[model samples]
Target: MRILWTTLLMACAAACTQPANKSVPETIEPDEAHIALAETLTPADPTLAPIYDRSCRACHALDGLGAPLTGHAAAWAPRLEERGMEGLLGSIHAGRGAMPSMGYCADCTDDNFRALIEFMSTEGQS
Candidate 1:
């Protein structure tokens, strides 16, 4: 039975080792409205402010200086124009050249991440 299991596992591994598919087309780009929505989605985390204050305010700064608060519309505008929302989030998730992963907010969820970016991007809008 063990021999049969091992052989079956090896065969499965071999089959799974196939080369990556190269024929899939690129994803369709998001339209202006979709992009706007991605950049403006409001989340429902009431703890976001306290979370930011406790975990994020140090480096990012409340006034958009140190790390540039997420709410600052101008600072993020050029980045959004150049990289798009996903690009910016990837930087936060994987850490940019300077910014650390998850921007150091360990408790943040995907929603928190989106909310942070959206809220910060609108910093100067008001």
Candidate 2:
């Protein structure tokens, strides 16, 4: 009985510590082309464009920074669905993760944040 219990424990430990499959990458990095394109993406609305450029673009447009890449619907979908608009705005207001408070847009109103969120969360934006 003691031998059987020891064997089971050893088996469980070995199984738990086995390295993850190398065939599946832990993180898929975006290529340079995608990064370049992300850099140029902006909100279509002129009013929102500057704000996005100044405040949101730096982190949101880049990959591997923990911020969701702008215009990536799949990345933004779970956040939007889970938090809804108001909760997202609250995150911006209070700052979440690497994002600064109010997303670094000091003068932006709730409406501005709403529009910016809409633009960033959408796909196929120019």
Candidate 3:
């Protein structure tokens, strides 16, 4: 009876410890083309101005300085260069610092997050 109990415990532990399948869920891959769009920004992109105005500007500041200014390239440069585009996108989507997820931009899509990060980094001294 003890041996049977031990076997049952081991089986339960194995089941609990097992790693989920690698492709069990969907994965998001940042699109480079989306980042490129930020480089040649225009006021016409209604989403950009509004997103910044309504949501991000409060914390990140009007000039991307709300939490801290975007003027300091050194601050954002390393994160951008080291983490790369995908990493930045994930951070934005996931939130960081005093920033809440989505930066309060409820309708933010992958393209939108990529665009915002690119916009913030593009003006960087880097």
lDDT of 1 at 49: 68
Instruction: Score every model by TM-score.
Output: 0.54, 0.72, 0.54
Question: CA lDDT, every prediction?
Answer: 0.54, 0.73, 0.52
Against the true structure, what is every candidate's RMSD? 16.6, 13.1, 17.1
The weakest ten consecutive residues by lDDT in model 1 span 21-30
Candidate 3, residue 100: lDDT: 86
Ranking by lDDT: 2, 1, 3
> For each predicted model, how many residue pairs clash, with residues at least 3 apart or on different chains?
3, 0, 7
Ten-residue stretch with the least lDDT total in model 3: 21-30
Better of 2 and 3 by lDDT: 2
Model 3 Cα lDDT, one tens digit per residue, 66-120:
3433333233444554456788778777887767887898887888877766665
- How does candidate 2 score on lDDT? 0.73
Q: Candidate 2, residues 1-126: lDDT per residue as tens digits? A: 534643553454346443333332222344555567677798879999999999999898988898877766555655654567898999999999888899889999999999998888776586
